[model samples]
Structures are given as structure tokens and as C-alpha cells.
Target chain A: MSLTPSKRAYVPFVSVEHMMGLVHHIGIEQVLTDLASEIEADFRRWPLFDKTPRVASHSDVGVIELMPTSDGETYGFKYVNGHPKNTAEGLQTVTAFGLLAEVDSGYPTLLSEMTLLTALRTAATSAMAAKHLAPKGARTMAMIGNGAQSEFQCLAFKAVCGIDTVRLYDIDTSATTRCAGNLAANGLTVVECRSGQEAMEGAQIITTCTADKQYATILTDNMVGSGVHINAIGGDCPGKTELHRDILLRSSIFVEYPPQTRVEGEIQQLEHDHAVTELWKVIEGQVSGRTDDRQITLFDSVGFAIEDFSALRYIAKAVKGTPFFTELDMIADPDDPRDLFGMFQRAKS
Target chain B: MSLTPSKRAYVPFVSVEHMMGLVHHIGIEQVLTDLASEIEADFRRWPLFDKTPRVASHSDVGVIELMPTSDGETYGFKYVNGHPKNTAEGLQTVTAFGLLAEVDSGYPTLLSEMTLLTALRTAATSAMAAKHLAPKGARTMAMIGNGAQSEFQCLAFKAVCGIDTVRLYDIDTSATTRCAGNLAANGLTVVECRSGQEAMEGAQIITTCTADKQYATILTDNMVGSGVHINAIGGDCPGKTELHRDILLRSSIFVEYPPQTRVEGEIQQLEHDHAVTELWKVIEGQVSGRTDDRQITLFDSVGFAIEDFSALRYIAKAVKGTPFFTELDMIADPDDPRDLFGMFQRAKS
Candidate 1:
């Protein structure tokens, strides 16, 4: 029996640098547009997925998690961490990576840095939610918390929802300046607002992407206008939230997966019996979405594995034609399936 | 505060070869014996564990799976693949690896090759069951499948249960010869038998670990003698059974994690309500063990993530003094935790 590494043994891994380059090349808006479609397509066939909330390993300072999903054929999982203190030491508060593999031979097909992709996908998911949940003709957006993810959120709304005006606010005026500065090249009108209230004025879509790991409220009920869509992003973990309880109570909430969103999203403040709709059901046409033009709609945007799965698929396609992929020796090739011991014995320590 | 790479970084990873070397250095028998205790210690606190069956991605030729579990403080997961046809092309039917992380920080503290460790843990778990379930004075073991895992299973029984005689049988005589040859230095009386019945004669334990992806009976109803303990390892997946239905009906079956074993273990053929005791209950002294010498005890050993967790712990300890460890760039350290984009902007693509 002849045993050799298959000609198809290479698994392309996208590093943080490589992924960033790809994102830079495609431009953030294009990436978000493509990712939105990918996420929508995957969510349509939700029954084929073996879905579960990520298995998280939380540390005192932060959290590390593995989010896995399978579509009966291909399996995908992401390794991500969120450490608010990491920023104090010059490390990003959130870093991530992911793997995709074949179910049959257990061969890894792709390994990619998900840090950048997470930012992109989060923005895409927010835009997707706003598309279905936002009021019709929503052209103005308020982006509170102008940090690493704020730029992507602005561009996604601009590219996907035809929002021409983006109002930015942050405790750090420099962050707002930087966010507005980036959008300078994107041909969108940018307003560097002084407070959340200023940014929310006349804005149809409001996004909160703050990085603080606390229960601090960036949005109050008085700041919200009628018929506004709220994209709550930063209130992901147990102690973190963006909108005040009063704001959430006033809005009709939608979530990625309710069981998970109940703990990590803004809905953590709500009672278990409180009603909410899963975004997929809305996309699947199983539930009504944003029935009235003046109704408040909230997309409690705690990220999900399916979105990462979608992002991985998007990047895999995006990197296919570029030199932005690296390969890793992630799996084994044994000459004789019975000779597992022999394979181990032959490998170098 | 100066945070250097050395202060925060662990060693590089221990690859498949390094793990095999550690096993050979410590001797497989000793590793399995130690693993038996580790598993017992964890199993005693089984209620604290959050258990779930692995999330599998199935393909036409094989399957890849991610198995995850947590005990509130620590979280662990294993990535594994099973490709029956891989052996024909020189790949082992199974290849695996896993990680252990602290629950608080979500940092992966340990990453090790589980390919070799899986074999060791499977053997350890079987011996653990045999320690309490096998008939007293069970010395002679009949090994029906003399493949790569055969030696480990035999030696584990030897080290854990004082089995001094191993009666070997396989459809391929060379496999039996190889098993005997590998165990020559272990000082056991190795008997080569032509058939399963011949191998079972006077043997107190029968271990069936054949790799055929079919319902191939390595043990028939007539072959299992009274008071014999059976370790059924190969019948781990659906439609994969090594024992006749009547044999399982006659034996007092004990299992690891019932939800999993019901789908993958030897008792998958049995009726849904077939009585089986969880091995942990027996370990905790909550349940009675082998009541009489005439009773047949069967360990429906569908391997669980906890055993892998324990095995990863065992190997980590064994390699503590050795240079067989390596760390991967699995996690990220962003300079300025809030500025995740800067990492990408500055990183060399």
C-alpha cells in the first residue's frame, strides 16, 4: 500500500496581517456587503446546522471562547478572546482566529485570523438586522462609541442600507475624530457629535460599539427618537451593556439567538419570559419584523457562531484569488490507518 | 508595567511525535495507570461537569468532530477525526488534539496532541471500569483486535488490574504477532489464538477494538464465558459493533456519559431503556459493582471529552521535566487592547 501526503494537503491559513491586507484590498464596505449575503444565505438553511452557543472559558480579566457549528459536511469553529484591560497594556481588547475542516477526512481546509473578520462580521450582522428591523427610508445613522469597530459599522450601513450621514460620538473626542477621518475617504457625510444625545438627533439607526466592560449606559430613553433602530453591540458579556433598561423596555428587541443573547446581549436585563424574536426567524419569514414605521426596533447584537461561520466563508472566497493565505500543518496523514502509533513514531518531536 | 513575551508566553506545543516520545519514555502502561486515577478523580465530580456530545462534521469518507466540556472553573475541548478508509492510504483512522484553558481568563493553558493520548486514555478508561466491574482475580485478557491500540489496552489492564496473560486473536495473524512482539518486554504470557472463541477460553477479560467500519462480530454470544468482563472499544459509532446483540443482553453494561454512549457505544443496539449504570456512580460508591463472580460486566466505552481532558492532564504532567513541549501562536496580544485595528495596520503581511 502506497501512502503519501495527498496533493490536496495544504490548508490555507489567513493570518491577522494577511486577513487585514485582504480586507484593505477589498475595502471595508465591500467586505461587509459580501459578508451580509453570506450570513443571510447560511441563516436560510438554519435547520442543517447543529447550533449551540460558544463554549466560553472566562478568565478574571477577560474571556476566551470556542464557537463551533456544523452543516453536516463542513465544520467550523472560532477561538476568540475579549479582555478590556488588554487595551491598557497596548493589546487589543478582542483578538480572534478560526478553523474550517472537512467532516469526512477531518482535513483542515482553512485557518484564518478572525480578529479583523469579527469586526467586519459584527458590522455586517448589524446592518443585516437594521435592514429588516429598521424603519423604511432610514438614511441617517448615529454611531455611539467610535472605537475599532465603529468604522466598519458606519461603512456597512452606508454600503448596505444607503445611509449617507453618520453621526459619531465617544467620550474620547479623538476616537470620534479618527472615525470621522476614516469616513472622509468613503464619500459619506460624517458628524462628530459631542454626546450620545447629539448623535441620536434625527438619526433613524443608532449603533453602540463602545469597548468599556461595564454596565455604563451610552443610550438613555430620552436620547432615542421615534422609529429609530438600535444596534446594541458592546453590551456583549454579563456586566457589559450599551442601552439603559428604560431604552430596552421601550424598544421591541430582536436577537441572534435568544438563549445566548439573554445572557450576553442587552436582554440580560429582561425577564426570561419577556418576548423577543430571533433574527433568523425574521429573515426566514417565520416572524413579523418592524410592522410599523414609527415603532422602536432593537437588534441586540451579541455575535453568534453562524456569523463567524459566514465570515469564514466570505474570507475563504475573498482570499482565494489573493496571496493572503498561509498554510499550517494542522492534521495528520498516516500511511496505514491502523498504524496510528507508527505515524506518531515517525513524526519529529 | 513591562510585559515581556517570556512572562506571558508558555512553551511551544507538544506535537504528535513529542507525545509519542513522552509515552515511550514513561512507558505506555504507567501513563495509562496514572490516567486511570486522573479520570477517577474527575469522574467523582461528574455532576460539576457540563457534558455534551461532540459536534461532528460528517463527510463522505470520514468525520471531524469538536468535543467540548467544562467544570465551571476550567474548560476543555478536543478536535478529532475518524476516517476508516484513511488507513489504506497510510493515514490513521483517527487523529486528534485538544486544549485546556482556565475558565476565568479564557487563556489556553495546555495544548497537546491527543492522537497518542486518545489511545492511552481509552485504555485507561477501560481499565478504570475493569478495576471495579471486572471479576476478582481477572488476570487473563483476550484481545480480539491486535491493532495499534491493542498493546496499550493490554498493558493498561496489566498495570491496573494485574493481568499477566494476554490471549490475542485477529483475522490478520500478523497483527497478533505484532501485538505479541510489542508486549514481549512486558513479561506477560502472550498466547496466539486462531479465533475469538479460542482467545476467550479461560480469559477473564475480553477486549474488542477492531477498526472495521461495520457490524463485524469479534465476539459471539457463545464465546463470552460467565464472569468475563468485556471492554468494547471499537463499537463506538452508529452501526459499529463488535459484540453480538445477545452478548450485550447477557452482560451487565456500565457506561460513561449515557447520552453519548447510547448513540456510540456497544449498547446502541439495545433497546433505549436498557438498564446501564454510569461508571461515575460506581466510582463514587453510590452504586454496587460486580455482585457475583458469575456476573458479566461490560464497559460500553464510548470515549468522552472528560477522559481526553484527564489524559491531556496526565501527559502534561508526564512531560513536565522534558523538553517535549511547544507553544503555538494560538492567541493574540494586541498592543492597545482597544485599538484592534492597529495590530493589523502595523503587522507585517
Candidate 2:
């Protein structure tokens, strides 16, 4: 018997190599811009989504979480891990993959490596939030953590928020050097700074994405200034925070999902009932993002499932008729649905 | 500039074809027997496992679920869907896949097609329960539903419980014919019955595996006699049941997980706090299974994540150095963990 799989048996898989090729093929800047647009569009329809806090399995070393969401037609989920100690052992601190399935049949349509796509989407989401909340005519961004995510954040800001310069700082100077070297040829003017305060000087947008498992303040209250947008990316899990509580007190905070952000974001340090604005509300015009120039706006982003869903949707669209993905025979398609045993028996020959 | 993946970058994937080959390579009867042993061992250490009720997304037509469990050393999850109406549309009513990851680093170790493996494990689990709870010298099993799972159940019982005869009955006589034809070459003596009553004649074990999304009475109260172990497999989802309530009221109920079985198993028809014995307790010697010969025992099998975890562990061990599985380049392992952007840039060549 010929083993040609039917359409339902195959799922398109975008590997790490293909995902990188896709980013380069579409031009990383364009991918980020398009992802930002898609995320913004999804946020506009937030009410239609089935949202829940990610299902997490915590271990002594790190956490692995499954973030799932559906918009009535498509269902998406991301399996992500965060082990801060992995980097010291020559492994990624965060690696991820995701799937998009048809809700009608509950069959997966796409399975893609989300490690690279996650960086792209995180940068896009941060830049998109900055575009809505940053000071008018923002031209410079201070990236405090010069880590794996630094270069993507710089480029995303350059593409989506129109920033042309980035000031980089990290306690480990080699990280700042690496970040500056990557951005040197990417059409952005890069400045390596001696300290976080130096990086924050004259910057209209500050992005803190430090990697730490504890509640160490990467940015003190004195470092942040008025009229700037602060993008807090790290401090995603419990006991991890980057910004000072005083800084959070002064800023008008925005979050992806309140139930999740309250548990995993910088706001986890504050009272449970701390007031904050939902980003979707701002995108939907139900709430204002930045009403005054001098008001400090903070996007406390603990990544949500819907953003991953949006990124999966974007990849599913971008890979159509392209050679960036291969079909994986993932589902079992017996010729007779009730004769799976017979299918197994026949395969013996 | 070589693109060869590092050691940690690859995850082993067993496709449906590879899974079928693996089963044949190991001998199907041996696989089922070994799976039963593995599941029984896991059940003995059930308190060490981290368990949660499966997260399910229900629709009008079917339901999809994510079942996850961890034993501190390893973590596993299965993505499964059930749509009873699918067979009429030329699709399998159920399909599944699963992953096992390292708990320390949260890296996936294996990805396998679990639709075939799920059938194997479910049969193994049912037979394992029957071995402990069935009447001594049980030779004949009345399998009321002749569908996809019927053959595996028949084989598992023969291999694990020493059953030599299987009497089959189905609402559709063609189903019964197909089932009997498949088992004709096997060692068991197959008998086709015109009604449920004929199938139960002289049978020490009664297995109801019908498929429907309604309150089905495949075995009425008058049909089920005393001292027969009823393996209830098809009443796995809410509003979908096989045996009548009268049958449940008289039988001593056993379940995998009380929280899940209460909501998805035949026990769902009972009260919220209905008394039921956990199967693991029996395996651990903390509770008795069959204390007398004339008492009816029912195994309310709703399927649990730990069973999938055990099956995954068995596959991960069985496929070692074998050609039955292939390696997949799933994880992105950049030489410098902090230089993900640089990795993408270097991959451009």
C-alpha cells in the first residue's frame, strides 16, 4: 500500500533554520512591522478571544508553561521554558515553539519554532506599545539589558516606533559590546554606555530586559524621567522584577492581561488591586494611553497567549507558497477511521 | 558557518509510520504487556506525580484537551481531540500526539505520534485494571463496541489477563464483522453476537466501548450480571455514557483520578461526592480491588496524563538505538546563548 498521507495527516512545520530563513527572507524589519500590525489588530478584537492564564509547571530550576487561546475559529498555544541558569550552561534562557489548529476539527495546521518568532513578537509588541504611549517624536531608546533580546528590540523600535538611535548598558560589558556590534550595521546609531543612568540620559524610551530570577532593581526610581515610555520585559515569573516600586508608582502602567501580568510582571511587587490599564482597551479606544506628554507611561509586559497566537497567525500567513516550512506527518490518518487496528496490521507487509 | 545542529538542538520524533514499525519491531503483544507493567508501576508511585485535571476546550461538535503531568524528573503532555461524528465524515473520531521533556532544563526529549500509542496504552491500562479486579480464571470478555479500540482491547486482555475468548457485539453488524475478521487470525476465539445479551453469555468480563456523544445505554441494568468486571471505556466525556445508572449503582467503582473521572467518566452521572476507589490505591496496596467473587467491579476509565507520561517513558526507552524513530532539529542552540540575533545573521549565508 502506498503511504501517501492525506491532507489532514500532514502539518506544516517551520524549524529553527526555516524560521531564521523566513526572518531574513522577509527582512527582519518587515517581519517585525507586520507582526506589530497583526498584534495591534488582534488587540482590537480582544473581546472575541478565549483568554486564560497560562498552565504552568514549575520546577526548582525554572518553569515550563503552556499558553493557549482561541478566537472561535483558530486555536493557538505556545510551549515555553524560562531557565535563567541555562545561559551559564551554554543554553538559551528562553526557548519556545507553538501550534495553530483549526477549531472545527481540532487538527493542527502549523507547528513552528517560536524561539526566534518570540523574540520578533516580543520586540514588535514592545515597539507597538511604545508607538502608542511613547513621547511624541521619540528618537532614542535606552536598552538596559544587552542580552539575546537587545538587538531585536533596537531594530523593532527603529522599524515600528521610528527610533534611530539606541543606548545600551549591562553590568557585563561584553553583553553591551555584543549588542552594539550587532546594531552597528543595522542602520541604527549604537552607543555603549557605562551605566544604566548613562544609557537613560536624554532617551525618550527605556527598555529593561535583564535576566535574573530574583527581585533585583535594574532601574532605580531616579533613573526614569518624565514623558518617557518604560518597557519592562523581564521579571516575567514570580520573584523576578526589574523596575523599582517607586518608579512603578509614578508611571501610568499598562498590561497585556491583568490576571497574568499581576502574577508574573513587575506589578507582582505591588498590591493585588493595583490600578492599571489594559492594553487592548487603549488599542480599542476604550481608554487613553498617553493623554499628557509629561506623564510617565509604563508597559509592564508579561507575555500573554494571545500575542503568541497573533505571531502564529502571522507565520501561518507569511509561509504560504513559500519554501520556509516542511510538511510533517504528525496525525494518524487510517484509511478506515474505525479500522486503525487493520491499518497497523496492513503496514506489516 | 556550518549549520550542523549541536547535540542539544535535536529532539527525537516518532511518526505514525515509525510508531507502527516500533510496535511491530517489539511485537505488539509484548508492547502491550510492557505498557501495562509501566502504567502499573507509575500508578504505584502516584503520589509523587504532579497531577491536574486536563484543560479542555469544548465546542459544539467535539472537545480538545491538554493533559500534563510531571514526576520531578520528567514532564509530559498530550494534545488529544475527540469528535464522535468524525467517522461518518471519513475522519478518525480521536487523534493524539505527546511530548516528553527534561524537567531540569525544560528541553523536549521526544515527540511521538500518540494516536497509535494512545490506543496501545488505553488497552494496556484497561487490561491492567482488569488483571487486578477481574474474577479469577476469567476466560471470555464481552466487548460491546466493535470500533477502532476493540482489537487492542481484545489483544491486551489476552496478553495480560490470559483471556482466550472474546465475544463481540455492535449496533452495526458490519462493525462486528470487521472486528471479528481482524481477530480471526489471532489466537483468540471470536464469537459474533446478534445482541448485547448474547455477547454477555458466560463472559466473566464485560467491556463497553461504544462511541456516541449522548447518554447511551449500550448495556442496560438487566443485561449486566453480578461478578463480572465491566471495563467502561466509552463513557469518557460529559453527556457521553454507555452503561445505565442502575448498573453503576450496584458496581464497586474504580477510577484513575477522582477529580477528572468525576467530571468525564460514568461517575459523572452520580453525585458530586459519590464514593469511588482510586485505581492507584489498589496498585499501591493501600486499598483492596476484589475481595469477593460475586461482587461487581467497574473500572471507570477517563484516561489521565500520567498514563500518557508512562507511555512516553516506555517509548523513549524502547526506541533507543533503533531505526524506528528519527531526530528532529527542533530547538535553537546558538553557540552564544546571548547572541540569538547574531545566530540569525550568521545563518543568512
The candidate scoring highest on TM-score is: 2
Q: Model 2: which residue pairs collide?
A: none
Instruction: Quantify all predictions' global Cα lDDT against the true fold.
Output: 0.80, 0.93
Per-residue C-alpha lDDT of model 2 across residues B119-182, encoded as one tens digit per residue: 9999999999999999999999999999999999999999999999999999999999999999
**DockQ, model 1, C-alpha based:** 0.35
Tens digit per residue, CA lDDT, model 1, A258-328: 77899898988889878998888889999999988778999998899989988887788888879987654
Q: Tell me what TM-score chain A of model 2 achieves.
A: 0.99
Q: Identify the CAPRI category of the predicted complex in candidate 2.
A: high
Please report how far candidate 1 places residue A78 from its true position, in Å: 2.5
Q: How large is the interface RMSD of each prediction?
A: 3.4, 0.8
